[model samples]
Structure formats: structure tokens, C-alpha cells
Target chain A: MPEYTFLVVEDSPTMRQLISFALKRIPGSTIVEAGDGIDALKKLSNQKFDVILTDINMPLMDGLKLVSMVRNDPTYKDIPVIVITTEGADDARERGISLGANAYVSKPIQTQDLLNTVNEIIKSKA
Target chain B: MAKDSDSLSKKVENFLKVFKKGEEFTQELLQENEKLRYRLAQQEEVSKSSGRGEALNEQALEERLKTLEDENKSLLDRYHQVEEENKDFANRYIEVETENNNLANLYVASYQLHSTLDFNESLKIVLEIVMNLIGAEEFSIMMLDEKTNELSIVAQEGMGQDARKSIKMGSGIIGQVAKTGDAFYRDGDPTNLKGIDYTHPLVTIPLKIKEHVIGIIVIYKLLIQKTEFSNVDYELFSMLAGHAATALFSSKLYSQSERKLTTIQSFLDLLKEK
Candidate 1:
């Protein structure tokens, strides 16, 4: 029973809550919220996180920039990143993965799909 | 001397006969011993072969047992794998069921919205649909005033009092959509809640009866966790545009008819008194 700390970054409170709700279903999972990419970076600096789930579109900084920054940083670079993309944003999904995101989930998200993606990334990393 | 020689010969002859008989008897005994030995050897060979056959059978049984044990282990492993697969499928089925339930709830909510003929109740239902189903945090339902040619807020949520100003027809985004009967959706990310002007809402659905626009549903911002509008949201919007307008219109007409009926009844009563 390993404890997992997750950093969820999204501009919309509703989406963040939904994703967090799904993530909380995993046993021993601790969730931390961020409104955008900048806020995510701040949280990353404060403490270690096992996985990062971020929405691609945001007010100040989008998820792609955050992913690239995380990938570049020596400390957080190894942490798995899962990008949340809108349903039709195929280009953005590809770009996010190319930018070093481990995996992704489309918007209008199915809770099961999101969970499976996160669980897979976490298991692979473990 | 002749008599003694004859007697020696007779004695030799008898001794020879007796010696021959003894030799013949000894030869017979030796032959019997050899036959017995051959028989013993054959019996010993048969007994040794029986023992060897038993050993081979034991070895074969041990090998068969080992093979069966291995097969049993493999079958057990396969059984566990199948069990795991079944559990996975069950989990997936439950998720699908939950999704179906949510969609059903939305359907029921929409049905209830149209069932009501009361204007206020219609507004309440619309608010619930927007807030709960659409995940709108800041929104307002503005009805078009035919006389004034303006759109006024009939019901609102999460907006300041000062923000609820009426818009002239074809004036701003909400008004233009109301005038044209075309829905207004902001380009790019709906969740990007930075510098949101109340005039330009995230979505402005013109509630229409055919080509005629009756009212507008303006959503300035969505709830924090709502990343983007889903397919169901689009469907909901399409539904509200037509059904909500008809409900509100019918209810208003019903209210007006009730008022006229009341006036006519009072006049009849007055005439009877006179």
C-alpha cells in the first residue's frame, strides 16, 4: 500500500474537482490542486509528487508549457505527466506527448479512462 | 598256476563290469545336475525380468504423476488469470452503468423542465439544468421583451446585482445572438477564465421558437472543475433552445388568459348585481 501524491493542474474548478474525485478513488492517494501551469510549478517546488495530471488549456500557462518545464527540471523531470486534452485536439495531444508527457486523457472525460491512464503510468513507474 | 590265472581273469572281468555300471550311474547323475542348473537359470531369468518390468512401471508412473502435477499448476495459473480478467470486466461494467445513470438523470431533468407550464417553475428548472448539468458557475437567463425590444434578465446565478443590466436588441454579443437566433460560443478554450467580460459570455444560446428568437441563456463562466463543454452539453443546449422557449411562452400565455378570464367573470357578477 504505497501512498501516491498527485498534482492536478486545471483552470476550471469543475474539471479539477472531477479529476480529483476520480483520483481519490485510488487508495492512499493524496491530491493537490493548481489553477494553472504556474501554480503547478509552485506546488512542484514545494514538495515531491508521484504523478501530474494537467489540462492543456489554462489562463496564465497551459499544460504543455508546464510539461516541458517539468521535463527539463532535474528534480521533477522523472515524474510522470498526464495531459488532459479536449476531444478534438488531436494536434495538441500529439504535441503534449512530444513535449515529454507520459500519457493523456481526452476531455468530456470518462472517469474510468482517466483512472486507467493514471494507474498505468503510476504502475509503470513503480 | 593255470587255475590261479583263470581265477584272476574272472575277478578282473567282474570288476570291469561293476566299474562300467558305476561310471554309467555317475554320468546319469551329472546329466541330471546339468538339467537342474539350466532350469534354475531359466527361472532366475524370468524372476529378474519381472523385477525389471516392475521398476519400469514405477518409473513410468512417477513421470506421469510429475506431468500431471505440472499440468495442474498450469491450469491453476490459467484459472487465476481468467478470474482477474473477469474482475476487470465487472469493474468496467459498473463504470458504464454509472455513466448510463447520469445520462438518464439528465434526460429526466429535461423532461421535467418541459412538463411545467408555470413560468417561474420553468426558470427554476432551467437554472438547475445549467448549474448541475452544464456546470455553469456564472450565468443568467434573459427573456426578450417584445415591446421594449430589449433582453432583460429573468433569472441569474453568481453575478453581481449591478451586472444584470438589460441589453438592447442587436447591441452586444448576447443581444446579437438574440436578434439573429444564432447561438454564440466563444472561440478557443471555454475554461480559460481570464479577463471575462460580462458582455461576452462563454456561451449564449438564443432560445428560439422556429426562426423567431424569444430569449437568451447567457453563461459567463463555467464551474471551476468543468474543463470544457461536452457533447451532452451541446445536446442540452440544443434542447433548451427550443423546448424552454415553448414552455416559457405557453406558460406566459396561460397566465394572461387566466387574468382575462378573472376580469370577465367579475364584470358578469357586477352586471347581475345591477
Candidate 2:
């Protein structure tokens, strides 16, 4: 299998770390971290990513807007986008998905579920 | 005739065997067709039911997601409100702390003002209080001599030699305050120092002994960090006005009494020797 690169966008450092830790389960996977949607966009423009995992609520630019921008952009539209959100964020999740988020994982995210979802999306794309 | 009967029976037997075989084959094919048709119907039903179930599930998920999003929004709003409240509390805490600190400073200033009986030491304490607590960098304490009607500098800080050493009573703002026995706060005006070589006077507190004005404390300039005097500084000035004069006056009387007592005691001893 080819090496996979993932972009993790979350405002909370701890949440970002947890997601990064779980992404490490995939062999030969590289992870990039961003503090918020704006930072994620900067990183997105600068590099290539196989998948983008983001939180719904973030400062300076939310995950929904990021998803819209990614989907609208020709270069990054096909990239698999995942949303991570709290349990009560149904509306935000819906917006995220409608804007072209491929999947959403609710908190507290089970490591296996996260891995399964990510792997399935990557496999389907592959 | 017997041979002819045998051949007809054989032909009839052959026809019966072929008819029976054809009927059995037709029955088997119909049963197989019916089983295949039933299986196909079941598969179609399963697929239709599953498609309906998936739609229902997606609808349920959408509803659930909506509810969760509302709850999340509510929680975030509450979190922001709590953060605002915390910030307000922190600001209030700082204000209260500063007020307490100012009160503490005033108490310390009053204590230092009356801690000594020596006139010079008392004057030094007053200067120290003004410089340290009142945040004045340039100032002086001047005593009024009733005999000459003149005010002379007793204690001074942060002034050039060209600064005024004496001011006759009834002359300038300083004289007006001394004559009227009223304290003056100039608010650190540069206009007041336009023609004067002396440093600017921000405030002048009159020191009173009973109803009489005994001296004046002139605050020439405030420290660089302090922009202006507050109400608390005025409160301190009022406290110094009464207590400072009493301390100085009583200490002068005490020394005079001690000297007179010593002379009388020595004279009595000489009489006892006689």
C-alpha cells in the first residue's frame, strides 16, 4: 500500500492529539495538524493530503466553511473529508456533510470506529 | 387371429409407457418453475423493504443530528457567558484589591507621621510619606515663623539650588494657602510653573496647630509613574494636616519643658546643699 497523508484540524490541542494518536494506527501514515479552519486552509494550499479530519466548532473559520471551500476548489474537492464533533452538534454535522464532508465522528470518538471509517474511505478511494 | 391380438396389445402397452413418462416430466418442470418464481418474489420483497428501512434510518439520523447540533450550540453559548462572568469577577477582584492596598498605604503613612517626637525626624517622616506613599518626587515642608511673617523650607527633596528657599506670608499661592489655612491642589498644572524657576507644585497641604496654620507641605512634582492624585491622596493630606502639626508642636513643647525642669532641679539641689 502507498503511504497515506492526513490533515487533522481541531482547535483543542488535546483533541487534535487524540485524533493524531488514533491515526497513527494506520501503518505508513503521515499526519499534519492545524489549530483551526484558517490554519487548515493554509496547510491545505501548501501540501497534498489523502484525507482531512476536522472539528465542527473552531475559531477564525469553522469546519463547515472549510468543507465548502475544499469541495468547491477543483484541486481538493475529491479529497475525503471527515468531521469530528461533540454529541449534541447535529445541525453542525448536517451542515458539514451537506457541504461535502464524507463522514462525521461524534465524541467521545471510539478509536476503532474512527480507524474503520478512515480506512474504509481510504480503501474505497484507493 | 391370436398373433394379430398379441401385436395390438404390444402397441397399446408401448403407447401407455410413453404417455406416463411425458406426464411425469411435465409435473417436474411445473414444480421447478413455481419454486424459482417464489424465490425471486422473496428477493424482490427483501430489497424493497431494505430500501425503505435505509430511508427511515437516514431520516432518524438527520433528526438526531439536528437535536445534537442545537444542544451543542446551547452549550457553547453558556460557555461564553461563563467566560464573560469570570472576566468580570477578575476585574472586580483587582479593583477591590487596589482599594484595600490604598487603605493600607494611608494607615502606614499616618503611623509614620506620628512615630517620632523629634521635630527634624517628624519632618523627615512627612517627606518620606509624600515621596513613598503619595508618589511625589519633588516637594518641600516649610515652617512659618510668626515673628518675621515668613515661611522657610525645613525639609526639601528633588529640587535644584535655584529653587525658592523662602516665601513671605501673603505673597503667592503658597502664602495664600498658609494665610487662609486651606489646602490647595493644583492638579500638576504646567501653567502654574510658567514663570517660576522652582519645580511645579501639584498640591500644598497646610499644617495646623490648634486653629493656627504652623507650616505648609508643598508637593512640587509627582513621580513619573503617577499621572495625578486621587481622592485617597486628598484624604491622606487631610490626615497629615492635623496630626503632623500636633506631633511637631507637642515635641517642641516637650523639649522646652524638659530643659526648664532640669534647671529647677539643679537649683533645688544647691539649696539642699546650703
Ten residues in sequence with the least summed lDDT for candidate 2 chain B: B188-197
**For model 1, how does the per-residue alpha-carbon lDDT over B1-274 read when each residue is reduced to its tens digit?**
2244345546555655655565565556556555655655665567577766555645555565566556555655655565565556556555554565345445545676777678888787778678755777789999998999999999999886557579999998888999889998897767655746787789999999999999999998776668788766887799889888888888888888988999999999999999
Model 1 steric clash total? 8
Which 10-residue window in model 1 chain B sums to the lowest lDDT?
Answer: B1-10
- Most DockQ-accurate candidate: 1
* Residue A67's lDDT in candidate 1: 95
Docking level for model 1: incorrect
Give candidate 2 misplaced runs (Cα > 4 Å). A1-126, B1-50, B188-196, B209-211, B223-227, B230-232
Residue B95 in model 1: lDDT: 53
Stretches off by above 4 angstroms in model 1 are A1-126, B1-88, B147-149, B161-164, B168-172, B179-182, B187-195, B229-232
lDDT of 1 by residue, A21-122 (tens): 678767799999999999999999999999999999888899999999999999889999999886557899999999999999976566678888998988
Complex DockQ per candidate: 0.02, 0.01
